[model samples]
Target chain A: MNGGTNRSRFSDLVDDRVDEGVFRVDRAIYTDKAVFEAEIERIFEGGWVFLCHESQVAKPGDYWATEIGRQPVFVMRQTDGSLGCFINACSHRGAVVTPLKQGNANVITCRFHGWVYDRGGRCVSIKNEEAGYAATERSGGRFDLRRIGALDSYKGFVFGSLSSDVPALRDHLAAAARWIDLLADQAQNGLEVVPGCSTYVVHGNWKLQAENSVDGYHVTTLHSVFAATTAQREARDATAGMGRTESGRIKGKVPSGTYDLGNGHMGLWAQHITPHVRPIYEARAWLEEKLKPAEVEWILNRGRNLYLFPNAMLMDNPSTQIRLVKPVSAALTEVTVYCIAPKGESKTARAARLRKFEDFYLTAGMATSDDAAALEAVQDGSLGPPSQWNDMTRGLSDLVAGPDRDARDLGFEPASSCPDWDHEGMFHGFYRAWLERLEKGSGVA
Target chain B: MSTNGIDPALEREVTALINREAMLLDRRRWEEWLDLYAEDAVYWVPAWATEEETTTDPETQLNLIYLKNRGRLEDRVFRIESRQSWASLPLDRTVHVIGNVLVESAEGDAVEATANCIVHVYGKKGAATRGSRYDFAFRRIDGALRIARKKVIFIDDRLEGPVDIYHL
Candidate 1:
């Protein structure tokens, strides 16, 4: 809100004391418009963003529309069956060139001025070319959509960045890439996002969603209703068919852990969850056959909610949901939700995945609704003299220096690890990454 | 196109049942609202897949809500009754306006009808207006009319915030 008039105060927003084990985030980061603008430029546009999966645009001419920060963009399967990401705006007047969320069109015509673009990022035709302009005005660059600086796909997950200063997509993912391999490598073929999406707004800052995505600690309390409903239903022997998986009674928190997969990526993982009812349960035998003993153990029974930082979450705890988080303002965020599954699975497993997806993931679902409500409450209360910081120093005593025993056994190393799954320590890493980005963007780093 | 020999009592009964549904929902009479539904009721709100079309199959496609049986509804009601459903519990003040009711047919002990509904929800979060098309199939069970299926087509596909059964 101050817009950096008080530079010293802005610098002190995050109170991260590693030696003292104290981490407190200034609440202004959630409600300040200035901070939100910085986030859009530095973290979003200046770094990598999760675009749609390869399966979403599998064939030539297939396209998907999305937003990187607040900029409208689209990804398409080029005529040669390669992927291309571009600004959705026309080169002429900046009108959105592709309007549909998903479609197949080899050539797209801007409805505003009749500028046509080919699948390969070429300006095929411009309206009234000879009469309207000389050779210079008709240059290819002026007529085509702006191409993304770097576009890459890691394990079927596509990412785009406008700024070339960031790390490569694989390095950016860091330890989280192995975590994604857990989902992507589930089936012999890769994963595919189920058709159709649910886009809904949450009245809260995007960081609230970022924090909430990997915060396992809040599930027992915040989604008590979901747990209770599932508990009561199981107790009554009514949780049978109609897409309900065997996610047995979600009672108290089980033995779980958290991962600080550096570069702001993190995860909340629990073992011995209802593995029998998980949709992937059907493919467990094949997974064991294909993966190592430790990997199979981790992949089969463990429940995970992995955060890719800034913009996305891949969850498989209650069910499988791919969340694309977009910040609209300090107090508003939009989320695009989808059910993702192995590329080719049995009919029963596919049905169970979709059903479980419907059960507790969407805005209309039992769990996320509560999450949205709680987040709104957090945003509504993000202010004033009584409190300057959000206390985030949970489970510090249990934090291991680097890659705990389980992580080491799995052949992956995280920046840090925690025995307790619900610990808020992962957020400390998130805030650090966030601070670094904002400082670098503002030229203070 | 023509109402030739449509029973006046049937009209009154269907109209009363629909009106009572609105009144009970607005009054937070969840248990009574449950009574209006058959145990095997299919309460569905399909999600739009494209600009002009909704995803057709709930079994394989995405849906805003697709509770196939009354038990799922009961789970929602149970959660709301727990006073822990903060999403819509501590419940919103809702005024449901239902109109344009038309009876499509009457076959044996079943009746089919369609209507339009708009719910004005006011709460601490703010106010939201939800408009939808309600397709209902009512069946006579033990001398009382009960909803066998209720499909709601929401007017606004892009939901602004958390939406619950109360909102729809």
Candidate 2:
């Protein structure tokens, strides 16, 4: 309530009841349209949203169109080889320019009436001899498309924010940046998107999947089928399962810890609620033949999952796959899975990695089956009366507040912790930062 | 049999091979189905419709899925055998109907047959039942036609959710 007092009417329903070991949150957070609208303004717009990588638009005329917080935008490589992002709308009649997903174009022409613009977002041509259109006062900028307010990248992962008041991408990413770097640093030739996407739509809310990304608790209940199959590899001792900080990390990685970087970037290393078990060593000799020893080390082991708040997720080691979620409605979300491989990886090595990936996490996986079932069921429940509150109390007692009110220290018991708090931590941080942007008087940035 | 100037005998042999392969898949006789491939045979599925020229390398093309060489195909079969294979748990039932078996070319060492196929996949995992059709390619390897590629371009390729476990 300290920061959310001026938020939309929906925040008033938040059940702030916190017990010693757990916290009970209201289910209205998932069902309210007002809350959802607030989320688009606060979270999606206020937090750093991943757009694309430097590798994607490396040369001039190269462009990729996508959305950041419901605002359709395109990221293009300028003539000088620098990257810039702008709204995809045309200036003439507000039509979308460069509608294609990806292509190399020097001047993007609006299909509606052929109003053309250069790669630098300058409206260079207005067709049919329009007289006063060039001086139109309503245009957002020189181009009909508005430039993305803030854009930046760490390593090669480029991100853009809609709100001018949100924190810098680097400061917002905090500890999560190292995991993303490890993804590229550990790759043999570094990673690149493997051409096509494995896409599909689910009948559920977008936040459900975002929360599921780091919620280790669901592996036992919702993904029990996956557990039954992977039980062979699940940790039998206290130190083996998800709650333990050293379960999946290298023997000496991170010293068995969880870090809460301020501004909502959370790192739950070695605590992958699910499992990452594939025989990467079988291809190590084959990988070493094409890469240096250090590169092979990075490619074959160490890095795990990296999540930039809101919607993007990356798996660093074994192989790289990015899951980008786009919400179609309150009850439907479209998720696209792009498998990534090193630029010059051998055919055999690439195939092996792809097969291993499909075997474990693709649309053909046990966990995915469980998630689809769960998401649909949650949507069904939301249709009935919304629950008064949703509980997020698992590790509330262990939370040690830092000097910053938004920062806190905690242990790794994400599996049993309330509201799926480990995953919710970053989400809540995103929400708080987003709320600050919407309030007229709140100081942000 | 002679849909497009294809020789009768070659057409019969091609149809028989495809029917046998379909029978193998239906019976879950994976080992036998795999036997019909050439040692260096490549199995591919283009994500989109192709006009005779599409790269077989999954890395280069925007393919829905591709399996290179016999070893890779065998690996796919092995995944189904693995206990953890989530996609194949309720083993999907499919009927592959192959038609329009025409020998586009009868060049040396390899023969290409362009065919139309309607595959019906039926199964239930919880409450979800998924079925689809396939516009496919079958190639004559060492004189007998084999499933070089079975690409099931789903009518809803853009939808989100777990697509069913098996190919249609």
Candidate 3:
């Protein structure tokens, strides 16, 4: 690891020495309260963060409550068929407008004082407006609730930004948009988020999950138990001549790699399991009928773990899931995981998808619990003085150059070249983008 | 007609079975706990959702766990016992208290029972109290009451936090 050099205010927090392909981030970034607060302001508040799936608010009156950094926000479907993202706080006294996790409501009245707001976020009624002596105040829209600067959807995935100056959602998405297209293209009609998310909090920094989502390096080691169990099941199934597509078949060797999608986005791609065991495999004929043969092959053969910067991740193949990470504190993070499936899937395909989801990502499942434990242990270890810098140079030497290698590569476009599956280039790219956003001191528009 | 009220004799037998299952979990006797289930048993721990939400349909709704048969349950136990389950590496000390056992109905060979359970977990991180409602369907297999189906609804479902289901 290279020694750090002071560059910006948070330079002490991240050591980005790209010349030597060495990136070491200070552990304090995970445990320091001040650093956490600064991240909320400079990173999350400034960048485009995923809010919820469009299907969650498919109906005009539907709304799903979520947060960007510490700001509570809700995404509601307006009568005009457009989605409106608003701050959950009421303009009156700053109380939360909608307390429910999710529901349908034509008009949301603040629970505190019954200040009614329409789906468009215009304050239509203030409890006893006439008694408040606010004839001019009411007409001028003084009490209209504040709205998020940008709200956009790409392939049914919704994202909101707190800063208006941030780039458009399409520009923010960049290369990551291609992976999202792959995910949405699985279904002919579209994909829908399964109802009821598996929510849990981890005693670790939010970045741990961000890194873990694309960190293929830890799968073989941290989740060895899962691998072992799968191996045993496969042995037994083979002995019994059971040819059913089991969920826990261990893949011995397959081509895999990592891509550094631009705008802090990264993806881990690998070979998919047998078609019989995976829904994407079962939907091959259907997808092929609608899509080109190469497109169908890409959907079936490639398994993707796409990270949309700061928070959300879409895990495609093996099973489809959306992981949303929210930082509660420097050491406490909340995650809500949703299982998503392509619309109009056969009953057998949906069942297989659900089973595969349970085998991996569920709270009690083999993989997620293991990852959670490892992340918590990392957080605990970082609290001590033993280690200061967390190294992310595993596959840095093998990073494939982007399209604009001569200039500053924003990683906006995909390259035919790929890195080793277990490489740490994704982490390097992620932290680089994170440091840039922090240094810019505003949204990376 | 059979009485709708709890059957005293059946309640004692069912309560003992429930307590025995808890003891096996606390002691980490995974194989023995596995023996408490019949060959074709279904174990479900539904995700925490609103009161109106129906999690019975696992395909449509989310569940923390939904094991179809005894084989899958055995697989879960094997993972924990193999010392490969990272979450169960430093096994947390747990004490399960099973009470309020009510035998809701007793058919010819199957019995339906509800019990309130409180699991106190003590680990290196800290201690936590998890409450749940356990609905069980017990079948008399070879004159021994074995769990055919177990549906666990965690009372603290809304609280999104680390959940170690190894001992649940």
Candidate 4:
């Protein structure tokens, strides 16, 4: 009922008022607390959201804690090798079961009341069980810890949904699977998440980051410092006779475009640089030997920033990165970034990957630092009354259907697409999916 | 502990060098800061976690800040001085508290030293205090101590917000 009430108000906050072929969004959507709460209920809780990578919990009993719609949840690898995702609260007193971020544990015991649950989420033990409960109560299902509605993985990336009515994880991923395959296929032995993460809080709405993840328009302007540094580094390397420049990967003309992968998934594709210095490029022979030629071509040419609707963004350009966006408040978001690499790689290639990752994705990295500041500034400006609409109309005239190669090889129909990298069609497609989800109400109990 | 007491003059010189470096950083004298490093100097700020040992290997471990040589450090300073880094716009005013300077060892021309450092930063957002243990490997070059390697281990590794360009 609350979601329904907010759904009616969302229309007022988001104006489709077109001005000179530009679509404008009102400022209220970014600052409204009610809208934020509604989004948590309708979108986050009612759909399949990414949890953690399967490689992160490869061994049995390994667990990783995270949140789904503000509710603390965790995923653990069972003895049978299946993943079990459970609400982090104990069934007895509702206290958090495991407080640590991640670890290896067969039984997670609630420190509050000592309620223990196995990796399967079955209630296995309780402190003072005989004295605190009757025989009938002890054997009842009331004490069993609740499991998430669904748990599934595609290409080693785990996803969970809070609502049972939502489609399967693969169905939820849909056309996005093609890009996921390209990311995973680059590794000869599959991909693994590198240890450690960089986390920082930003004073901005969560949606801003989701849009910024795939928006290529801001790269040349907002990240001018990074561009300049790279150019200078390349020139210096060439002058010093260093043979090859590491920054050269980002140089020169690379054909770029954006594709709407449907179901709120979108991708920005750009041509890759030389393969000698890149790990993905270095894996070419192995990948060509393993996968089809088209798939290999996708891996070679497809440098992508792929967004999995709601929370996760996988970037294969510059370096492999996985960014998780968590909403703290209507005007606040916390981001966690992780570097991913091929399972087995030479030390030289791995080092190259790490260097590329640190160059742009780290907290002190040029690109992220700029984007964080810019987002906060935008949040500050949205409070003003003069500008009610944010225009997303660049490259609207160049919109085209998805390419035939995508349709034939990946089973992808001609979805919305644009040849230019700096297009607003991806943003429009994202918001369209967002509006549909918000209007559908919270279909989960 | 050293069997023989540290030379008071050596101690004074090392302490003075650190204090001068701090002053140069606070004043944003980019070129002077660059001159304090040897050509092969390494400046590292290792990542921190609650219950894990501080990472020392920049090649394998994640580091908040890792510069391999003087060229990388110079490039970093160049970015800050270019007036194009958005994070440096309206720069945060900072004061460095360098104290408890100790000469841990002296071998050949290289002297290993340890010190306590706390930086208080004031910006438009708010204020933040970053406390760290500074480990320095200094070698005498051109009759003056130049840093061969400087490692900063932050006491509280979890940052309160985005790290300023020059705070470390």
lDDT, each prediction: 0.82, 0.57, 0.78, 0.78
Q: In model 3, what is the error at residue A190, expressed in angstroms?
A: 0.4
Clashing pairs in 4: none
Residue pairs with colliding backbones in model 3 are A262-A411
Is candidate 1 or 4 superior in DockQ? 1
Put down candidate 4 lDDT per residue, A4-118, tens digits, no spaces. Answer: 3243656655555433576767776778777888889999988889999998889999999889988899999999998899998999988888768788998888899788888
Per-residue lDDT tens digits for candidate 4, residues B50-122, read: 2366655687656677777787777777777888877777777889999999999888799999999889988
In terms of TM-score, the best-performing candidate is 1
Clashes per candidate, residues 3 or more apart or on different chains = 0, 18, 1, 0
lDDT of 4 at A100: 84
Query: What does candidate 2's lDDT look like per residue over B19-113, in tens digits?
Result: 77767877788898788776566554444322223334565534544555666556556556664444455566776676665566665545666
lDDT of 3 by residue, B1-168 (tens): 236666678888999999999998888787888899998898988875554563668766678788777877777767878887777778778999999988888889999999999998887568888888899999999999999999998766534334555447
In candidate 1, list every pair of residues with a backbone clash: none
The per-residue C-alpha lDDT of model 2 at residue A6 equals 46
Which stretches in model 1 have alpha-carbon errors above 4 Å?
A1-10, A135-140, A240-250, A442-445, B1-8
Interface RMSD of each: 1.4, 6.4, 2.4, 2.2
Q: lDDT tens digits, residues A1-445, model 1?
A: 3334333344588898967978898888998877887889888888888987898899999999888877888999998877999988888898888869889997999998898999976788888888888867756476778887789998889999877667888999989998998888886887777766788888899999989888777777887778778767666655554344334224575778888898999888887556777778788789888899888877778888899977999887656788988898888888889888887787777777776777789878888888888899898777654556799888888888789899998877788898887688888888888988888873212
Q: Which candidate gets the maximum DockQ versus the true structure?
A: 1
Two-chain DockQ for each candidate model: 0.71, 0.22, 0.56, 0.50
